[model samples]
Target: MRGIAAAGAYVPRFRLPAEELASAWGTSHASGIRRKAVPAVDEDALTMAVEAAERALSSDAVDRDELTLTAVATTTPPAEEGELLPRLVRALALPKSVETATVGGHTAAGAEALSRALDAEGPALVVVADCPEGDPAEGDHPLGAGAAAFVVDDDPSAPVTGTAWHTEETPGVRFRERGGEEVDSLGVTTYQRNAVREAVTDAVSSLPVDPADVDAAAVHQPDGRFPYRATADLPVSNEAVSAGTVVDRIGDAGAATVPLGLLAALDDADAALDGDAESDANAESDTDAESDADDAGDVENEPNGAGPSIAAFFGGGTAVAVAVEGGLAVEGIADLDGGATIDYVSYLRERGYVVDGEVAGGGAHVSLPNWRRSLDQRYRLVAGVCPECGSVSFPPEGACQSCRSRVEFTEFEAPRTGTVRALTVIGQGGAPPEFAELQQRDGAYAVAIVELDADAGRVRLPAQITDADPGDVAVGDEVRATVRRIYEQEGVPRYGVKFEPTA
Candidate 1:
């Protein structure tokens, strides 16, 4: 009965149109791909993973306290040897005793992580995030960024019935050397096509269910064309494969491609079932009154009749196929909305390929020890409440701000939704050295002092505003806290809460 209880996905809010890239390099647009999702200056695999995982956990399909394991899969981790799992655990507020593992080194790692989660004895959270980059002039494929997460447990929703794996050494199709920033490909069309067909056919052939019986299929999508091309000789129909094709919109998201496609297919299957039930109800209403009870019962049972779905993931000389049946789709699992389109110059500047000059220096530097100590306050909005005076203090100075009491204070988590109390716009040269890069990439930005309600008292926090223009934000606006990159210092990203307009 173990399967995906809930699923979630994240696509960055900035999109670089295919024409933008084409115009930048004086080349024609890649066929079928319109645009690609681009991460903001502050966004990377870790932040995007946290965003997706939070949405999945919030679906209420699995209890947070019952989660015993968390596995993250990513080909582009923020730091090579850094402690990524720890940061994820802290951000999610998971128990310190929870077992954590990181999986990577190939694009198919997401499917591998999902397989392990379904096999685990207890509930597990699996997250796959990647921001694949390559020399735009070298390959026809457009590299993009995205993330997907799933909660796997014995809840019986979207039950995974069968799994298979196939692997061989097909060198040079796509690879990234150690300490390299871009992915390289051999551009061998015949070799790549043959490898995909052989691996996918072999894995699907080993499954217990007939390939023709699969209602939907999500295949590895390095590009919009490859996925459809790979399924030409398979038993599955083109319609079934098209149900999960997403690369045409968001481009190739590396480890996240297959998982995101699966989420989309699950949503489509659930929607189709809903439509069928509606049709049955409408037909039943036209029947005689005597058959109403029987017709209603049949309609209630219709959602459970959905057939099995297949998802095949292939990359780095490996392919995995999984069969899933009968599940409730989490709402809005594949919606990628509220995005802003940017031109080529902005895209290059944000990607750090068009640095105008040396990075401005002289911003005050905070020690790593101090930053570590404030993680709870910075990431989770944790405040301290004075037991004696009913006053809340941010960053918990160990002394009550109102009563001046020197006793220990109880920790409290502040509400994420708040109202802006004050605001300021930092335009161009007004930005500090730490924020100079951000200001340069993104035009003028706003900083706000937000007021949050606590158990005993209100807490006010000063934070940078995002996802909206500075001129558009004003005092008294409703806002919500979101984790984003604050700045980079000492070759490490500093993550903290940023306010964004709720509307």
Candidate 2:
């Protein structure tokens, strides 16, 4: 039951142009970036994870008795918020018998999730995908919409082979401390590099398996360049690089980067199970796992019909690398062939009526965040707290927290941004079906209690940070929410809203 049986990738339907992103950043990768998949309108970490999981399952058969669900939630970099694993896991169509869990606290938690999945009983299905926060650093602006997945099972056609990994723990370089009103990024390059070197080296060295045996790698990162630098000394071959390196194109994907790296590898090598396996069994695999040779891509069952084996690894910044290996072939369930321009204004107001920046006499004024010039639209969120008891809800609801009041409406979008009311990291999340990897590099996706800047007695709510580090999150920071993928079904745009970092 253990070979990479099938694979799938999910790129959100929305695609931001390189020009737009570059314009916002004051500099850009003219060619554009391939940001990780993000759910649309109504999609969330759970739904995005499932979209990728469904794609992974579409290509293969997963035993209802054997499905084990695990996940990690991430946000865009600059816009700090929090990860919502609990909310997400429930969205999956997984059977009542299946076991499900949430992993968070740090970006690297994904690695830990990988490790757990690897140890699951029987043939297991592992899916990894992301919706990294968007603004922390605007890393997701260029191509920040989509999801990817791999199913790890015990099947033979395609299986995963895990090797060595280690921990590289450091306190400073990158931290997302959420205080009452804001998030602080005390990230120091020198410190990050020093720690990255230590953990990556330890993981690689511990493997003892020839660096040659290890195919190209995916690092826990938003940008693609750093991984190359970290593995410089390792025997990583160039042939195994993923397409749309973020460093050059999309930017950083936060918690989703590593999975995105794996997705990039899978996409670049569409049929990694068949054609790529044949053309580059040993060496090319180290560099390139497979290729998208034709439509209806299929890999012939091996002599035993067992598929090619893969070794998806997750290395977190905590200097910890967890390895998990299993089987399942997964790929995009929808077309990832197009890119779209984000219209935050239309996008936002279209979602009902979003207004977060300022207010006027009768209506709220929507002053798009600096990041929105490229990504048009803000979310039109309604305030739905219990009318009698006093509770806060994003979308206005008929029921109440205290008195279930159907009337007493004061609907509005997030007020004047907000701050981190509370936060936690995410690990293990939306994954490709049949994903097999030990543990991700130590990483954590953040989830935060967002308090609106509006005057509703410090409007507070929960949100997922779009594009920054969990450790870097803090309370009391200003932030604005926007419409992001709340979830999706068969590639349709399911919309909702989330928050991003704001200056």
Candidate 3:
């Protein structure tokens, strides 16, 4: 009876076109992809997961304390040593007692995380994200960056019936050399394609319902064509499986692919239900009008429920098939439009491959005690509210600034959407060493002072601008807060919220 209560996805705002890659490398074939989403210089797998989790939590309105477990699955983890899930937990403001785990090094880890969430005793959160490394010459197997998250509970809107899985200890199929950035792609396509197809076939045969009766279907997409190719021999048709097919556009998101495809399938199901409801409403309205006029009309209301949806998630050596019923409504998670395109040089710089093969100055070296002490203020942006004057200070200082009240201050809620009040352009020679790569890749970025009017009082914050042209941003522009990578110090990636102009 466990299923998805809510779902959400995150796609980066920058895209790299295949045509541009071809021009840069002088090779026409760039994985036959049109374009792929590119994370900003300040974006990564963890931040994208945070974005997706925020959307999922917003749609469900579940109390943070009620979530008993949090799972994050990613092949490209933020750091090699430190725990990743705790950072996500702190950022989302979940209860410290919530159990956390991280699954990695395989594309199928996402399915594993979701399966665990489904088996939990209470509400659980599963997040999948990846930023794979590709060959510089080949453009990283045409990699794209993104994340997806889902909330799972017994009384879920989309209930999962069961899962059928197949796995083996297949080694050397896909791997990376030690201390290498590029993944070796030797003989990977043939082995992976056949292995996935065989495993998926076996999985489908175990389902109770006939494959032909499935309302919608999705498969793990390594390339744009892999899904269609793998599912061709199955009983389902291409149209029925359209929701899970996204590799042609967004490229391969590694562990994030299956969950994103699941979101798409859920969205398709939601749209169909909406259409049916709207049609039924119209029919009833017409019937009412006819009854009022003493004429004749007939109207029928259909029962509300979700049909069966089949999904297959592939890891390097494993695959899982899931059948879900009573699917939930999807927020706008699949919209991949409106992104800025940069050239190959800019892409290289953005990915931190420029500047003598190192990111500038390695940024700030934040100590452990300082980092742990400011978790609430740094991650969740929690402020301190003075009980006497009700004024909020972002750092949650010891004493209230407004009334100098010596009493314990109330913790203010996180910042909401705000507008740019004052701004300045940081051109070349102005960016800090930590952001010099950003300046080199994207010229003349804006640093703004943003203002928000809350119930307590007016709040002002200084932040950097992303996903916009410096010339286009103005004082009155409205913006939303998003988690982004600040910098890496001592091999640790620091993340914080930055404001982006809302489109």
| Winning model by TM-score | 1
Candidate 3, 207-228: lDDT as tens digits? 7657776655768776767777
**Per-residue lDDT of 292 in model 2:** 34
Cα deviation in Å at residue 379, candidate 1? Answer: 1.2
User: Taking the tens digit of each residue's C-alpha lDDT, what string does model 2 give over 29-144?
Assistant: 32224332333444445455655655666663555345665444343321134334323333333445555545554555555555566667654445554454423233224234
Q: State the TM-score for model 3.
A: 0.89
CA shift of 492, model 2, Å? 22
Better of 1 and 3 by TM-score: 1
By TM-score, is 2 or 3 better?
3
Rank the candidate models, highest lDDT first: 1, 3, 2
Residue pairs with clashing backbones, model 3: 108-315, 134-140
The alpha-carbon root-mean-square deviation between model 2 and the true structure, to one decimal in Å, is 16.1
